[model samples]
Structure formats: structure tokens, C-alpha cells
Target chain A: MAIRYPNGRSYVGREPNKKPNRQKELTYSNRGMTLEEDLNETNLYYLEKAIAVIHKKPTPVQIVQVDYPKRSAAVIKEAYFKQASTTDYNGVYRGRYIDFEAKETKNKTSFPLSNFHAHQIEHMRQVLKQDGIAFVILRFSLTDEIYLLDALHLLYFYNQKDETRKSIRKSDIEKIGHSIKIGYHPRIDYLHIVDAVYFSDKL
Target chain B: MAIRYPNGRSYVGREPNKKPNRQKELTYSNRGMTLEEDLNETNLYYLEKAIAVIHKKPTPVQIVQVDYPKRSAAVIKEAYFKQASTTDYNGVYRGRYIDFEAKETKNKTSFPLSNFHAHQIEHMRQVLKQDGIAFVILRFSLTDEIYLLDALHLLYFYNQKDETRKSIRKSDIEKIGHSIKIGYHPRIDYLHIVDAVYFSDKL
Candidate 1:
């Protein structure tokens, strides 16, 4: 299986000079719903209900070729991701900067530490320094389980990656990270956790 | 010709009960460098030169599908655009919030007023109300010329759109928009216009 880049064209975080027509390798996906589709629908539901405002950041693409035969629309020919993004989603919720990275794992026992990068961990650290709310949404696709782990917990293991060289056990996630109950409206009820952790303090 | 959607999927700004896996009609695009790429390269150059802190807002996308086969990586299956964004680029420059949009047109006669969206115009209006500097960058790809048009100028014509079904003419852009010179470090020297518009008053 190959990694299917979420974006279109030859995107590699910087200017990519070529058009990659070759289909990249992709592994089998049996999670039923795509991570994006579910989250989008959930956000819409949340927006209608006016619970919170969290949005997935768009991939920074560099458009190289656009053919606009007419004045109505333009199609991209080649583009690349500007650079490795620091985080996936960020927005204002309850007057706090909420940042998060969502990932699904087929493994039933553990989630791999390699799913995250070092720089991403560093970026999360800065957000924490600014008193921002940061967490990672982990899904055990096999068991249909989801957990919201604070960025601090993820950072701890990330820093110890060289020493431990072990994946974060699923049991540890269930014990330490807050479990978010899936709902009909947002699908992932992450704000309940946010309200409990950050807003609760204000009270 | 139809509107060229960047990805193969349909644009889903609003929530849809069900999505069909159908290919959208092909639209023609004049392959050219996007205002984003130039600005990103320019931002990097500026950062390296210690000039300013400007970056394109990451595109917000909703991810729904994920395939984590062996636990090492997760791949996105389906996703959609979150919504119309607020602005293209924003950052701090010389202790001021700088925000603007970047657009390109092959048409040499006039940049169409349709190129600007209603929400974007409203967003800029709000930014200006809050005392943030707001503007748009128009690149005439055919002529390879770019202009930094202030929000005040854009809002003037934007408000007039309902009254006039016509666009702002090239002559008008030339008259009102600030012409930006391309440079090696930052391709588009937009900050120069910022200095002239915002800082010069202090001087």
C-alpha cells in the first residue's frame, strides 16, 4: 500500500516542478467512513448548533499551471504543498485557540508514534506556551473507539521516542486520554472534553 | 467550460446528505503561477531577510476517511473544503496586522469584479473596522504585472456591484491600485505598499 496524499498534484511542501501522473501506492482502508467526511459532517452539525468553531486548515498548495479558457473558473495543472504544516486543524472555541491532529489506526493494541513528526511536536509545545488548547483525536478503527489525548501526553512519548522506541499502548490511551463519546450531531464530541479541561477552570 | 475544481471531488462547502462519486465537468485553466506560490516564496525570502511575517492561511479541509493498515501511517480517503475562507495571507509586519487576498487573471482588459466574493469583501470590511490593514494582490498573468489594491478601494466597487453589472476596468485598477515591483528576495513587495499606506502616516 502507498500513501495517498490528501491534496491534488505534485505537492511536497515546497515548489514542485513536475506533474506526477503516476498513481502513488495506497493501502487498504476499511474504516468505513473517511476521516475527513465524518469530521466535516460533524463540524456542520456543530456549526448549526453553535457549539464551537473548529476548522481544518486547508493544505497550502502552490499552483503552477492553471488553464482558464474562459473567465468563470480555473483548473490547476501542477502545484505542491507549501511545507509540512505545523498542525491540521485550528480555530477559536470559547475564546481559546484550539489545535489538534486526528489520526486513525487499524491496530487494535497500539498506535504508532511514527504517525507524528518531531517538528509537529515542537509546534504544539509553542501553542501550549501561549495557553492554547491542544489535543490529538485518536481512533481505534478496528474497535471503533476514539480518544482525545492532550498534546502534552503525546509530546511526552514523542520526546522519549529514541529511548523507548515503542508505540503508545492502546490501554494507556484509554487510561490517560479522555474518551469522547460519539454523537449524532458532531460525530466526535471533543468540545465536551474541552469544556471540562479548559472552561471548567474559568468557573 | 465548467468551473475547474482543484480536486476530483465536488466542492462541498455545505453539508450534503450523501455524496456521489461522479467526476465533475472539466474546466479550462490557463496554466500559470498562482498568487499563493509567489507570495510563499516571497514570505520565505522576507523571513530569511528579516523583513516581515506574512503567510497564506492554510486551506481548511474536512477529512472523513482514513486507512491505517499496519499502524505506521494514515491515509485520507475523502474530504471537502470547509468553507469560503476569510483572507489569503495575514501576519504581523512592523507591529501591525497585515491581511490581504492574492488573485491572478489572464485578461488584460479589466479584472472582473466577480473575482471578489461577497463574504471576502465583508470580512475585509471587518478587518479594517478593527484597525487591521487589509488589501488584495492582483496579478495580470498575461502581462506579468501585479498590483496591491487597498480594501477601501475594493469595498467601494464591491458595494457598487449590485448597481453596476460591470467590472472595474484595467484603467481603473491602474489608477487606484498600487503597482508592486517584483524582487529577488520577496517576489511581490507588498509590504512596501503597507509602509506607504499605514506607516507613512506615523512618519
Candidate 2:
């Protein structure tokens, strides 16, 4: 299946011809779920159980020019981003702040350091200093495999990008990161990992 | 002087013409601080002293289409509102959850009930029921007067909207609502009201 990116470029995922039929669009539907939609569903399930209150931060946009035609609402005619965001989701979960960034890579071998921004690394450092739980949900789109890498692990590899010069190997990630099994109920049962990592020790 | 809305429609603020000139298209000096900017400044000051950790909830928008002009970034081309938000700000303060909505009204005699949506009212109702602090920060633009109206008082008048058939009177707000002194440091000085209303009884 082919997944088209924002740049009109497409990449083949796990099954070459397994693009699920959603209407007439021949887009790759990886079992009818994107990383965001899955996490959103998972968040809802967690919310219902009163496990955590997590919310996806709306993508921040710096609107440059706007045109309001009929006086209802302003329409952004032109805009530019000020900077890349630190994380994708943040919320109060069981009186503790939870912050994380979710990314999916088509590369089956390893996640690339280029997938993250320098500002995100800095932000994660600050979150850590404030005793907030921070992690990255990395999905190998080709294998449909997902892993939760703590900010410390991410920071270690991100810093190594300047020294070792290459990205972290798949073997290293597999060893260090917590593998999250995707399911039909919540899709990505990440809270189980959060429970095992964050809550259990505190309790 | 008329303050032009993005639509070129003019709206009456207290003193749009009072702004001292900076003489630039991109660098027009604002006469007074916006509610959001003031709240952010206030939050920063509070955070520095470990007084409270309050954050303005990011404005919610439904992004429809995006343009990836650069590989490193994505720009929102079109977007809309998903729904009305419940509150303006929420965070933890002294282990208690704080939630509130800030509004400014040009009308001096009374604050129009139209500012509070039905869904927001219901959301506040639930929050108050859950033993959470929910309130509204009202800024009377003409007098530069700000008041912290507790959710109970708001709900009382809101329920009587049909029976009384009138907007909330300024006199009533001044009577029941905790008057918050606007200051340059904290801007709204809302925590003082919070202290007086919620924590004072305990002390």
C-alpha cells in the first residue's frame, strides 16, 4: 500500500497492494487507522475508565494574512509557522502531567533522528526537569510496529546524532524502547506502558 | 478612533484611539494588553514563585486542509471550529484544579448573557459538581474593572435567564462577584480572588 505524504510523495508500507478501500481513494489505510486516529480513540477509552485525561494539542499555526468575506469568521489567506511544536499531546493524567510526541516512520529498520526537531529535544528536557512524564510513540509503518521510547532514550540518541553521526539502530531501539501492542479495543494500549512505567512505582 | 476587526468591520472597545502611535504597519503599539497575553504574563510570574501552575488552554480549531510548502513544516490552509470550548484556562494550584473563562464587555450597565454558551454553562455545572473551582473573569472595558464571578453566581443568574428575562446586572455582579484588582504584575490578580473565595474559608 502507498501512503502519500504532505509533499505529494508516496511510500509503500507493509503490504504493497493492501490499501484498504475507503470510498474510492486508493490511499493506504493500514487496517483502517492512522496513528493520530488510533491514539484519539485510545484516549477516549482511557478517559471513560477515568485512567487519564489526555488531549492532542491542536497544531499551532501563525496566521500571517486573513480575509473575512461575509463577516462570519476570518479565513486565513496566508500564513507561516513560527516554529515546530515540542510535543503532540499533553494533559493531566491522574494528577500527574503526561506529555508525549507520536511519530510514524516508513523505515522498518530504525527510527531516524531527523524525525525529531532540536526544539522538541529542548522542550522534552524542560518537561523532564519539571517532573513531567515524557515519551515518544514510534511506529514502524512498514511493520505496523509501535514502541514507546522515553525522553531519556530519545535524548541519548538525539545527542549522539552530532557525535556518532548516524541515526539510532533498529536493534538498539528494540532493546531499549517498550513495545506497544496495537489492539482493536483501544488500538494502541499505551496507558498500560504508562501504568507500568509511571504509576506502579509511585503506588 | 475605530478599532477594525479582521473583516474591516469596526467594533467599539473602550478606547481604541487612546493607543500611542508607534508608526509602523507590523509594529503598531497596542494601548492595552489583550486578555490572553496578560494571562500568559500572569501565569509566568505565578510559575516563577511556585504560586500556581495555570495555563491558557490553546484555542481549538478544526484544521481541514494543510499545505506542506516545506518538508520541515506544515501550514494550515483551511480550518473551522469543532465546538465551543468549556473554559479558557485550567491547571493545578495547590493540588486543586482551577478552571475559568475570561471575557471583556464594552457594555457598562450589564454583561450580556450571550457571551456564555449553553454547552459551556453545562460544562461548568459538571466541573462545579465535581468539587472543582470554576469561575468567570469579567473585564468591564469602560472602567477597566475586572471581577471574578464564581460559577455558582453565574449559574444562578443563568438559570433565571428565562424567568427574569434580563441580562446580569452590573450591580449584582459587583455585589456577589469578587472584585479583582487589575495590576501590571499579575495583570488580572485573579489568584487573590481564588484565595479569598476558596482557600480563605479553610484558613
Candidate 3:
């Protein structure tokens, strides 16, 4: 079966002719999963464990035409992708609203500002102003390193883009952001970082 | 112009030949707007005023085929609607997470359980378990009455569907739910009721 991720990436199963080697297959699958897929698995783990309730919002689409056939499901004939105005993932965590955007960069030195939209940054600002916990999950894919950077630092860097470098240096992220270790059960264990960053006082 | 609401309802503009009277047009427009449209406007109002940051999640779609035409946007050729696993709307309100499903019933006496899905009720349970606020915004279309009923009450009625009636009587909702008054600026001012119900002590 062909499965499509919310980000429009198609999940192609293993080739039918390939020899089923469990060890190699496991490693290949883990390496093949994208940042979004990792987060989706992590969120599912949270949900199943009754820890948190975060979900990646569906990709916004501008549905132009839909055909309804008798006694059958409506088929979308034409549609276009719509830019999202808010962060991708959001939900309740420990009685507080948690919102964040996740982006993976192949760049080793810095994460580019082009990964974010101005409206999304504005949305994060609004979330923070409303006392919601806002942040971004940055993944340096080449090194498999992920960091949870608070929206405060993100907003500051975003505003200084014109004056400063157009991207946030990896060194700066290491200094300010919380490192999240990738785990087996929950691929990206980000909530642990969220706990330390936002609920340290309570802890 | 033809505009489509997230709920799949298409908005047809006034006929070009009709005389446009300001007062009559205003009333006609308001009456024509669905509960979803009213909530969208209300959420936009809240966002603009810095009151809350609520949003309706996009309608989930499963894309089967796409055509990548040269030098233009990718066109979704074939797709089908996917059942939503969560509520229609959610966001931060006064530092707390708020989530809810909205539905309008033409029946004047009761709201049917068929309006909800099992996973949605399960999702609400998870949200409430995380200490987030959950509720349903129900509209009685016949009388144009709106109510914000807490998830506790809704869950109770939903669970009793098999034993008792498959619907919650309007009288019972009036007794348990908070009535939301429709206004000019924000069509349905639900946050005011949320303040009284959830944040009364803080108020």
C-alpha cells in the first residue's frame, strides 16, 4: 500500500524483490524517516502514554473542484496547496498550550531563515503574547542532531536577519537551544526538552 | 466569486441584478453564513484584538495523484477527503489550552450523537486528561440558538447514547450548557463564557 504523509511525501514500501533482512530493514527505515515522520511517531507515543496531546495540523489545501458520484466518495478533481499561517504542530501539554514548527536543514554551519515564513513568525509571536509555550524544533539532518529553540531566540534572530547573517549559526543554536536525543520508542524525544525549558520551576 | 468554507459549503455571492440595500444585505449575509463561517470570523476577530489564538484545522485530504506542470504550481489531480481524528478548532486562551468541535443541527428538540465520531470523543478525553479545556459549540439552526457545553457533559451524554436516547435533549443542554449570544463584531463570543466557566476565579 502506498501511504502519503501530510507533507505530500509518498511513503514507498520496500521493493517486493528485496530479500527481507530484519537488521538492514530496521536501520534503513529509521534512516529514511523524515523529521515530520519522527515527530508524528513521537506525538503518537505521547498520546498512547497519556502524556501530551500534540498533533501536526493537516496541510492546508485550496480545493477548487470536487466531483460527487452517486453512492461513492467525493473525488477532488483540482486543488492547490495553501500556505499555512500558523505553526505545523500544536496541542495541550501539562495544562498549557504548546505550539511549534519543525524544520530540518542539511547545512552543517547554519539553519537558513528561508525555512520559515513571516506570517508563521508572526503567529508564534501571537502565541507567546497569549502566554502559550512557543518554540521550534531544528534538526541538522547531516549530523542527526536536533535542538528545541525557544521562540524568543528565534524571533530575535529572525528580526536581525537583515543586519546579521540570514541564518542562525549552529554554534548559536548549541549555546541557547536544548538538545533532544533521538530514541527508539519516540523517535524525537522533544517533550523532555520542553519540560526542562518551560516547566523547570515546577519540576 | 465562489468561496468554499472549510466544511465543504460553497458561498454563492448575491445575484448581480438584485438591488443591494445596506441593511437588508447585512441581515441577508449574516443569515447565509454557516456556524463554521461565523466561528472563523469570530476567531479572526479574537486574533486581531489579541484576545485568543484559535484556529480551525484544515480539512484533511488524501492525495492520490498530482501533476507537476512546467513553470507553475503543482496541480492535485486526484484526492479524497480523510476523516479528521481531532476536533475542528483549538488554541490558547488565557494561558490554557482550549479545544472544541462545532456542529449545527436542524433539529430543534435534540442534538444527535451521530454528529460526533468515536475517535473525536476519544480525542476530547485525551485533551481533558492533559488538563486542557474541551467543549462543543452546538448550534440549533431551527431557532438560531448556540451553546457551549463542557466536554464532561458531552461525554456523559455520548456514553449514555446506547442506554438512553441517542441524542441530548435541548432542554437538558439549556440546563447544563452555557448559552452564547451572537453579536455584531464577534458573531459568537464564546470566550466570554469560557471566562466564566473555566477562569471565573481568575476573573
Best by DockQ: 3
Q: What ranking of all candidate models by TM-score puts the best one first?
A: 3, 2, 1
Q: What is the lDDT of residue B69 in candidate 3?
A: 100
Model 2, span A119-181: residue lDDT tens: 788767666765677899998876778899999989988887875656777788889999998
Model 2 ranges off by over 4 Å: A1-29, A48-51, A71-74, A82-86, A156-161, A165-176, A201-203, B1-30, B44-58, B63-86, B90-99, B119-135, B149-179, B189-203
**TM-score of each model, in listed order:** 0.54, 0.68, 0.87
lDDT of 2 at A105: 85
Each prediction's whole-model lDDT (CA): 0.69, 0.75, 0.92
Q: Which ten residues in a row have the lowest lDDT in candidate 2 chain A?
A: A20-29
Model 1 chain B: worst 10 consecutive residues (lDDT sum): B20-29
Task: Give the alpha carbon lDDT tens digit for every residue of B1-203 in model 3.
Answer: 67898988786666653654554454533367899999999999999999999999999999999999999999999999999999999999889999999999999899998999999999999999999999999999767899999999999998887856799999999999999988888989999999999999987
lDDT of 2 at B16: 60
The deviation in Å at residue A51 for candidate 1 is: 3.7
What global local distance difference test value does model 1 have?
A: 0.69
Candidate 1 structure quality by residue, lDDT tens digits, A71-174: 54344444444555467765555445567888888899999988887767865765676466778988887666789899999998787787566679998998
Using DockQ as the measure, name the better of candidate 2 and candidate 3: 3
